[model samples]
Target: MAWYDEAIFYHIYPLGLLGAPKENSYDGVTHRLKELDPWINHIKEIGCNALYIGPLFESVGHGYETTDYRKLDSRLGDNKDLKRFVKKCHDKGIRVILDGVFNHTGRDFFAFKDIKENREKSRYKDWYCNVNFGGNNEYNDGFSYDNWGGFNLLVKLNQRNPEVKDYICDTIRFWVSEFDIDGLRLDAADVLDFDFMKALRAVANEVKPEFWLMGEVIHGDYTRWVNEGTLHSVTNYVMHKALYSGHNDHNYFEIAHTQRWLDGMGGSSGQGFKLYNFVDNHDVERIFTKLSNKAHFTPVHILLYTLPGIPSIYYGSEFAIEGRKEKFSDASLRPALNIKDYKDSVKNNPATKLVAALGKVRSETPELSYGDYKELHLQNRQYAFSRNYDGRSVVVTVNNDDNDCMLTLPAGNSVEYVGALFGERITVNNGCIQVCVKANSGEIWVPAEKENKKKKLVELQTITEAGKISDASENKGASGTKEKSDTHSDINGIEADSHTEREEFEPSYEETSESNPAIEAKMNSMAESKKNSKIDSQLNSEAESRSDSKGNYEEGVIAGLQEAILAIMEKNGYVTDQMRNDVYNNTHHDSLVNWVKSFIR
Candidate 1:
């Protein structure tokens, strides 16, 4: 398995982290990059092993529109300074992942500029998209070219050109060979060509077989870019929105459905394909602003860590640093911060302690990394799920409601459970465990005693035999136990009489006598159904990855809805915040689309 499978990421917008100006300085200062050395311990303390540093390359502005691929951005440091910084990170047992903005380049990029100056005669004219000398240019360069997302300064590259592809591949190889980086987060990967992405993956694998390639895919089916020929993973924007919306709307069903649908999309392992999950990044508002209540932070962190993905925390988020993205500027979202700044902000904040504790829990738990997900129960403001691996299970329960809620676990083996957050001991009786989760809080429960290896072997054999013997196997056992239905004895060679007491534990179902073999048999049948459900869940999860057409259709519907909203806004002559909120909080996308269609008609 790749190290990223178990790794937790800490994302840093380097230019913002180092206090570099938004515009290029070309000052050639290296000292700002070194300030990260002191923060290495701070990163490790929160259980993050991977550092995803965004855009340290030479750029004209914001590091997205790159001018040079070979040199470091002069505003931050030189090549040597980066090498030293990377060395320090490696020495401290932290892996580095750089932001690869290969989709576009700045207008000042040498090759693009050459095409502009030389026009039709330039040999590098084909390096850019739609370079035409036939029309007047936006920048008055005597030619027109395609810019990324209508941004004239950010020129899109033509990867179809052999020379351009070769240049990008060589740049990737140079970074791997020189800095020994662990991974690359491809910027604007949604618009990037699939063939180019495959080639990029092959090149990165050739340099380092385990070199992770993640994409910045905001919409569409994630499996389109995360399958075998493309990237290792993509940003889990679906879950990101579901997460905050579930809290904001006080509807856990929204997120629960998303989790159930996507959790099994991770191939045969059903690990959900290791999405790069985050609550906030440089592109969005901070979690503090996203969440309606501050108390929901703990439960949100709990869900983030326990969900099937490689979770990440934006810089300063662990300490509740809040920032919102303005309409036309990202300056508020990505701010420069020193150690003193983080130190002062973290003081007296419970968010750090809560996030750190949750991070450590995720790091130590195997189920969180590679287990199959099965949502047990869900309501508008409460949810429960299980992560089971090799017969061991971890059950998670969350109550987003303002009042305490009691959850009755499905009937199963009588076992003990320990809360991952507080180490509180809980005992199960008659295959059922009931617990009350506090309002706006959650708990992670792990089996206190490991299952018996021999018993597991027996259960597997018995289940397989049941597939063939059908009712005979169950009948034979029933016949033997029928006479002693009133006696407490071994059923199927497993203990059935050990009961743990808790006055606080309330049973949702009616109590049955310990001597009732009929009740025991019924419970055992339910257990078998639960076991079959696990197998079905695994199959469903694998099938989920292959069902991309449905996702594509859904995306089309969403696009249509957005267009309808825009048209309506244009016609109405006013757009209110309530209308925006309605659009956002509408979990039933198709219903909203139909409503808009009717209103427009």
Candidate 2:
């Protein structure tokens, strides 16, 4: 398999992450790129094996308007600093990909400057698109030219020009030879010429074996760009939208439909292409701010890692930081942060621990990397799916509601499943397995027999016995023998069964009678320990959720609802500036709900 197929990517916008100046001053090198060394170690600690950081080339602003393709941005550092950084990443076994902004160049680029200085007589007049000396533009430079998103500052390139293609291809060769980079994330690739992408793929393959080429394609059929001659993958924006919206709207059907569409696009056997999957990126709002319910964080990431695609985590998102796009600026979405500030809280931070645990799970489980997708269960508030590979199956279930949910899913021929996160062993009866997923939580269940090899049999047996004890306790009657004390204490000094009131959705199991006090006492102790451990885990997770949800929950819900409505309207081409204003300005709960209902209809 190619390295990207199993790669867990950690995306870093270097200019934002390192606090480099937004505009290139053309001053001396600042060596700001070296600050990423700690982040590199942190990525490894979180189980990321690949890094996608870029737009490092010299740029006039935001790193996309390229001023010099051959040199590192002066605000970041010299080329030597990049070389050292890439070497450091490689030494730690992490693959690196840089942003390829080939479609456009800043107005200050040498070729563009030449066009401006020499007019029609310039030798590089053909380097840009639609360069007409007779007409003038917004800048009134005595010429007209095509640009990106109606921004004249970003001059579009003429990819059909042989010199331009050769220059870009040669730059790729330089990046490979000089920095030893592994791949490129082609910026604005949706508008790029197909012939140009084909040429890029050819050059990439020629320079290095298994060199990956992923594109920034927001819409349209991905097959057009991800075919053998073009690119290995494109940004999976369809799923990116579904992830946050599905959870916010309490609709799993949206997510399931998107998965089906992806499966259909990939053809029968499985998801043929490992499209890059992400919750949030530098261009959009952070997932923390996008999600209305903070508890859904775990489930969102659960799907990100377990779904059929290459998973990626945007920088600083793992810490549950909130960032939303302002009316005219995305500066909030890409804030500068230091890892050292979070060092003391890493262990206590629920999102951090969960991300790290998921990373470890993704790295260790081969099924997650190569498994075929299967939907075992689906509901508005709960979902279950399985990844099967080489006759081994790993099941993943998630609950998005504010209360616990009991999901009974098809297990096929599997007899049992072991929880990959907490080592909880669940028995399958009559080709079905029932799992009690906590509110806003998820579980990764590996077939018990397969998981057994990785874990000690004794420990597995102990856990199974404890599960049985807990199951029996659930069905015990009020007439049953009373315990010596009202509460049971565990090793961590946590109290279990402190309240007689059971949760509304707690499952009931068959009861059993134990005659021997010694044996029953031991089993009861083990069960209490298990229960206390779960309680401790829940407490930590809830603490994190509370910390993240410090703002008004009602306001978040209203904002999330408004965004969802706008997104749907935009998708349907019915959105207007007036509609957006109406949605944002009217904060009445009933009005927003009615608007959402109308859009849904």
Best by TM-score: 2
Candidate 2 lDDT over residue span 138-232, tens digit each? 45588877766434567889999999999999999999999999999998798899999999999988999999999998745678888899999
Estimated TM-score per prediction? 0.74, 0.75
How many clashes would you count in candidate 2? Answer: 0
Cα miss at 505, model 2 (Å)? Answer: 36
Model 1 spans with C-alpha error above 4 angstroms = 263-272, 344-348, 411-414, 449-601
Pairs clashing within candidate 2: none
What do the candidate models score in CA lDDT, each in turn?
A: 0.68, 0.74
Pick the lDDT winner.
Answer: 2
List model 1 lDDT by residue over 1-601, tens digit each: 6798888999998776665654565655555677778788888877788899978888866688788898888877778888888888888888899999888898788998788678888999898888878654325566666755433557779988889888999999999888888889998788898889989988977999689999988644678899879899998876887788778778786677666546445442244488899998876677877787767877888899887888999987887666653322344456555555445222234676566667777877788888877778877788888877767788889888779898898623437887766666677877777888878888888777554211211000000000011221121221232111100011100111111111012121113212233554565455555544543454344335433545665554554454454443333222334445545444345444343433211
